[model samples]
Target: MAACGLDFGTSNTTLGRWQDGAPRLLRLEGGHVTIPSAIFFAPGREAVIGRAAMSAYVEGVPGRLMRSLKSVLGSSLLEETTPVGRERVRFRDVIGRYLAGVKARAEAEAGKSFDTVVHGRPVHFIDDDPEGDRKAEDALRGIAESIGFRHVSFQYEPIAAALDYEQGIAREELALIADIGGGTSDFSIVRLSPERHSRADRAGDILANDGVRIGGTDFDRMLSLGTVMPLLGLGSPMRRGDLAVPNAYFHDLATWSSINRLYNSKTLREIEETRRDASRPELLGRLHAVVEGERGHSLAMEVEGAKIATSERGGARLDLGWIEGGLAAEIDRDGLVRHTGDLARRIAERIGRCLGQAGVGADAIDALFLTGGSTGLPHVRAALTTCLPQARVAEGDTFGSVGTGLTLEAARRAA
Candidate 1:
């Protein structure tokens, strides 16, 4: 069987296929170069992704389509989404559809059918669990099968990133990979040896990784709480009491930071209550969509739709102009910094604690491999740099790291 690679993450899912003696990213059929990990049910029995579902959401008919179901994987909620016309489907059912869509896209892109794949997940996914390795293996294999792959194996997300970082470690040395992503922050400590790296492709045993379930997405939430909330009057109204409806609305608004859109029937009530107060579901959905999976755009996107001008523009208006007498205050970029500061400190501290636990010192580590959507943040980058001043940090666009590394790994295995 030919091989493919997958990076199924909290914010997005990326694919890598074995082709022409190397791995290539699978280009989706839609105009978009990357397929959104998002899904929504529509009126015609068709599921929407990318721009289509997003557009419909803004138009106020989100249907049964959903996004960010990965976080609720083990919960009973995964098996029970809202009742759509008496048809009940679980979140995994949506995920199963996503896997199938990914497989179809891979087949189209490679122009051939591949039966096997190598996939990556975070290390804490394996490290924190008493059944870490086993859980990782089961989740990876189950996803592959659900998506139509016959055989598959799993590698750690950080480990894959490490392999991508140094495919050939000419010397034996300890290296740390700090992956701060939309879902969680994780790390890996490996004794990279040329001998081991060369042999890792065959047996997949040359990696040792430690991970934590905290990451940059949390920072986004913190910012939304501080700066974004103030703009929406969430801070004061929350303290005024009897603000459950709007408070819940603001709370849901903050949730957009992490990409957790698979809401319960209760969400309908939240919308209804807000509508009674003259809030538009479409506008609310638009705000949610902006912050959903674009972890790289967290702070900037909070000011989208006329509030913020550019990702680096710093200050922009929050466009509360439509809120029918809402405040017309000016929000600037410094607010983002203020909102994101504590989050940055927390991540830095977490990185330090993880390093200390492994008995590894900053000086002894050779390099810091960075990955995930949030890693693109200047603050996060600086945090890693500050925390590991002695180590070299990898540089690249945040979205390309894990899946791109998986592509590199597939070729290494094939060769």
Candidate 2:
């Protein structure tokens, strides 16, 4: 039985296979191992995935662009439909189609079909909602089986990352895996070594697992609201004097998962109404331009870029040319901290709880392994380090670790 590991992340996806006594990730898109978890339904054409989708949307192709598809899981919206082209498409089907594409590409790359797979999932799909979390997993499992996977199993994303890191270490160590992805931050404390690799059962090796719903997308939203949304009358006073411009519209625009909500006729009419009642009509007009132009995704992309850029430089420039010509915003590191500080603190507290659950002191941990795209942010690193100052920090393939680890697990299970 041939098996593979699939990391169906909110921001990106990767498929991996066990080969040559090691885990190997397949090239899913034009020799790229990672595919942007995005889809575009262009007019009169087939849906496209990854970079092609982003390009089509950015090129002004007439159709619907969907990103952050994973965020819909465990939410009521997962059962709903959205307008795409001339038809309404179910969100679950959208996810199924995307996963099917990944499966096809993986089979082509591996020269074989994979019936069994170990899929990576967050520790908690929905925070403080057990029913929703269960539904999310069930939904994912249903999607996987529907797409021809006969033997489907699950692995925590952070645990998968830990497994990948364990492969490179020669000695046993108490390791903490911090996986900060686009939609969640998950933590796992595990005992790992070369000796543990041969064991088929790792239930006893895992000490504790914890996670929070906060992630990169949340940071992007915070940054967007703090800097860009205000420019479009998010907090400006309405003509009624006592009331401020409605924030729901700006919040949806700032959030990748909710951006599509701003494209409807009702939302447009509401925006017009708000514009009429807005004391700063110019700002509301800018907001109208954004929603009317269907540029919410483009704007979110710009904000995401600025967030990533702020990690390296003192500040980053966001070009909002779609909103208005010569319109832009600058975001600094301090601003990033100000907007996301509470999130970082919460993440740090979660790490503390993980440690507490494992019955281990922070000093007892041997290493802190950081993976996932969001872990690259300096503020996130600082937050984690604050929790475990004595432990050495090691960075894994931010995007590939979980998939690679899943492949390793798949091979173990198949054997």
Candidate 3:
């Protein structure tokens, strides 16, 4: 039976197999190795995944767009039902169907069926909750097995990145691996060398592994809440009482996982009731329009795009005219720093805990290997590199490293 490695990440997914004596990622989406972790279901019809899903939603197709799928792993939302078009489906099945589609694409690309798989997982699915973490892993394992894998295993994401990094190293070195992705920021301190590359047992090489549930999506949420949500009457005062509008609806609307939760009739009625007392009914009306029209994901995509633009060019203009004519916002490097400073610090703090767990000083690390899409953020990268100034920075194939590394693990297990 064939084996492969699956990195079903929060923002993107990649599947890889050991081929021609090296780990190679399968082209799952039209010659692309990485596919956005998204799916769209249109009423009673079949579902489309990856970029097609995003495009269908953008093209005004009537469907439910589900993104940031990994965030539901440890949360109650995993088993909870959400409206997918005209039908209600559990998040678990939605995830399973997405994985199944990805597996089929990989098998078709490689011309081989895979039965055993190694999956990449964050060190902690939910921070500081051991039982929740275990439950999340168990749920993922069940999902993988349910999809068709006869045997399943998991490797910590950062460690998998480390393994991928180890392949090019010539001599022994203590390296720190930072995997800052869509849903979690995971870290690892590992000893890597050419000699260890062929070793089947790598338990002793991984000195420490730690993670926090903060990532690119969290950054996007913070940006949306701070900059975009207020325009939707998030903190506007009410006409009846001294209290401002309750923040729950806006919070859910800003968050990717919970956005769908606000589309129900109960939420619409509650929003209508809230609008009656709202001092600015026009803003509440916009909120009503967003939820009623299911435009939350579109707004989120705008925020994410702005975040990327701001990171790349130091400034970005958010055109929200589609929601309300002439409505817009601007975000720059300074605003990103102001809004996401706390999250960046928390990510840096994880690195400290990782070092302490390894019982090594920061200066002892020879290389700082960075992977995952979030690490491209300037401030987040600064926060980590500043903490380990002596270490040389090495960038991995941000979205592919973990899957490639996991394929190595799968190969080892098969052998």
Candidate 4:
């Protein structure tokens, strides 16, 4: 079997295998194309993914839902101590399900079980939270072993992404890969060989790497607060910042798997009473024809949806109709630019610094390879254009490049 490549990312996951001298991306189960980095838990302790999960969530049964499990890979969740459902599910257990899902998709596509898989790991994934990261990596390795894989390996995400772009690059050409992903914004500098055409012949070593735990996800959180929160005045004069207020919103958002964790009987009760006590005028007088109690939560959800869409779609509309009784200010593309611009600039600046430190000038970066779903934002593109004026910024398939490269690395080492 050709080596399987897995770019297991924070916001999206992708799988590819080599066939007929090219990498073939496996299509996911849903008609949907992207390998989304999200999962949802249903009432029966069953898991839904991609479209089905996203749909169940629109119906509003929150709690025990998990999304973006990749970021929490190295966490207490690994121990499975945090109990989900009647059974205990460790961080790896959840991850195993996700991996298994992807594996199944690939298995179906290839008409056979994949016996070898290579994983993409962040350089700091282990050191970031030493004990936990170790456990997380072990957990991932364990998954491959359990599936009867005979060989498995890991490659640094940025380096792997860099190799993906270096192939077919000319000799002595320089390249930089800015893997602005969901949980992190990281860049890698490398010098390339003219003969580079495959991961095996890439003939290069990593120059330098720098990363910050910031990416598109952070921007989403910021918009939730600076833009989406006050609409309901989650914090009144007395409760401002207390009871977690908007911070609670993020706490809820941090995990996309189970939305059920966010509310309890008491919290739900509070929401009910708060809805009555809130004067329509307090929200926006009669100017807003909608935005009642449930609408508030719905509105919050809609904003998140719009933001995700805007990331991919470039611009999305936030329809106030979702808000039932009262409405707050509208969120437009400009609002997104306002809240996320600083972050975009910071990421670009970091990339520039990494290039400088490696003694590779921006002009020498024959191409700036980009990965991660967050790189789709216009401002991020603008920042790169301004900072790397002389280089070609190649946009790799946001979801699959890392995994395919990692898989190629594994295959080369084994060969």
Candidate 4 all-Cα RMSD: 4.7
Root-mean-square deviation of every model = 5.6, 0.9, 0.8, 4.7
Cα lDDT tens digits, model 3, 280-340, are 9999999999999999999999999999999999999999998899999999999999999
Worst 10 residues of 3 by lDDT: 81-90
Question: What lDDT does the true structure give each of the candidates?
Answer: 0.59, 0.93, 0.94, 0.65
Put the candidates in lDDT order, highest first: 3, 2, 4, 1
* Residue 317 lDDT (model 3): 94
Candidate 4: deviation at residue 86, Å? 4.3
Worst 10 residues of 2 by lDDT: 314-323
Model 1 per-residue lDDT tens digits across residues 176-271: 777777666767776676677656443343334455555544554655666555444353422234453255545545553223332444554554
After aligning candidate 2 to the native by TM-score, how far in Å is the CA of 123 from where it should be? 0.3
In model 4, which runs have C-alpha deviations exceeding 4 angstroms?
30-33, 44-46, 59-64, 80-88, 126-135, 147-150, 168-171, 198-204, 239-246, 249-260, 269-301, 308-316, 326-329
Q: Which candidate is the best by lDDT?
A: 3
